[model samples]
Target: MTNLPKIGKPATNALNTINITTLEQVAQLDEHNLAKLHGMGPKAIGILKEALLEQGLSFSQLDEDLKNVKFTVLGDLKCDNAPKRRIIRDIVIASIVGDEKCLTEWLTDDLV
Candidate 1:
């Protein structure tokens, strides 16, 4: 089931144009960007806001530098152990904060 709220057809189409079909995806976009969409008027934005709040989620607070950042793993994950899980989580947090050193710390000689 889709988590996207019942915003009007025009507003829904606007979000779909950018591939935002889920509430989680919507949460990743800020108000400024959403407002810029042709069909996203104030009423639609408000409805989305309320829907998100009901689900205990809100739009991203991304600043200019962090707004378009993308993170990906090119290969299959090698392990599902706790330590590796923590390392992966740390790397994501470090990347968001621009901590290059923390990102590099996980890439030691033993890493496979």
Candidate 2:
């Protein structure tokens, strides 16, 4: 399990009690569910949200929303949006090289 952000003992204990020791695990829960955890306050939640974003991750609902967006690779392999283009390029490279682990981490099973 990866170390979570320093959200204080009470909030950390609240996450630990539910076996959420990794930011990936934290990403699985929506804000509503996280807010329901005893000892998890809004400040702690804000900290966790920032931590998750630093890793290019977000709550499950956001991931679900992203999955709804269709992706395509153009013939020229060029894009005006640097970040989105980089993401697309990375996925394409990962697919071409058969980087299953990278693909699995970035995509849902259905998308994979």
Candidate 3:
């Protein structure tokens, strides 16, 4: 969501804490749940909804057979284990693709 023009660091950090770490994830969340996240305020929610609308989408459209979106990771973490690499790869792909259920199934630790 950092790409969203009006969202500030606080709101971005808040969403990140809950593992809502992708723009696709933001679009999949209901406004009610989005409001409940500690750092999400009314203004942020409005900004998010408007951003989603600009994509020709809304929160409700996450289930519309959307494919996994491709993105490049820009960090120094190295994964030598093939299995772990694949798992991380799949989850990242799912996050990009707006696979809420897949993300939920795999990354449930520390979720609120």
Candidate 4:
């Protein structure tokens, strides 16, 4: 699971029960189904979401939201008040590349 943070024993057992021991499985998980699992809770789901997001993964329900904001940061980077030109240039290049994995992680980037 790539060392998930704040995954308690209870959540661990619950995930294990459902054969979800890896981050990949969790990435494909629907939030609703996860919430229905025994021992799962809002906090556990939040932790799972954070963990998935770290790998550029998200619940299927967030697909629209994620796509809607894909270019938002790119727009911000073009603004006059944007950060360093080099960083912006790299991001723009990455965007032009149009790689889904790259964009997913970079579009929502924060200070590294």
Residue 14 lDDT (model 2): 85
- The per-model lDDT (C-alpha) reads 0.77, 0.75, 0.66, 0.68
Residue pairs with colliding backbones in model 3 are 68-97
TM-score of each: 0.55, 0.53, 0.48, 0.50
Of 2 and 3, the candidate ahead on lDDT is 2
User: Can you give the lDDT of residue 55 in candidate 3?
Assistant: 73
Candidate 2 minimal-lDDT segment of 10 residues? 67-76
The best candidate in terms of lDDT:
1
TM-score comparison, 2 vs 4, better candidate: 2
Cα lDDT tens digits, model 4, 23-58, are: 777776667657767788899899889888988888
Off by over 4 Å in 1: 64-112
Regions of candidate 3 where Cα sits further than 4 Å from its true position: 61-112
Displacement of the residue 82 alpha carbon in candidate 4, Å: 60
Per-residue accuracy of model 1 over 1-112 as CA lDDT, tens digit each: 2378888999999888777788887887888768878889999999999988888889888588755666422222344567867678778778778888987788678888
C-alpha RMSD between model 2 and the true structure: 14.2
Best by TM-score: 1
lDDT of 3 by residue, 1-112 (tens): 4355467788887777766666677766656556666677888878888888787657744333432323233222354568767778778878767799989888987754
Winner on TM-score (1 vs 4): 1
Tens-digit per-residue lDDT, 1-112, candidate 2: 5569999888999888777789998987777667767899999999999999998888767345333334422223444568766766777868765799877777786762
Query: Clashes in model 4: which pairs?
Result: none
Candidate 4 global TM-score: 0.50
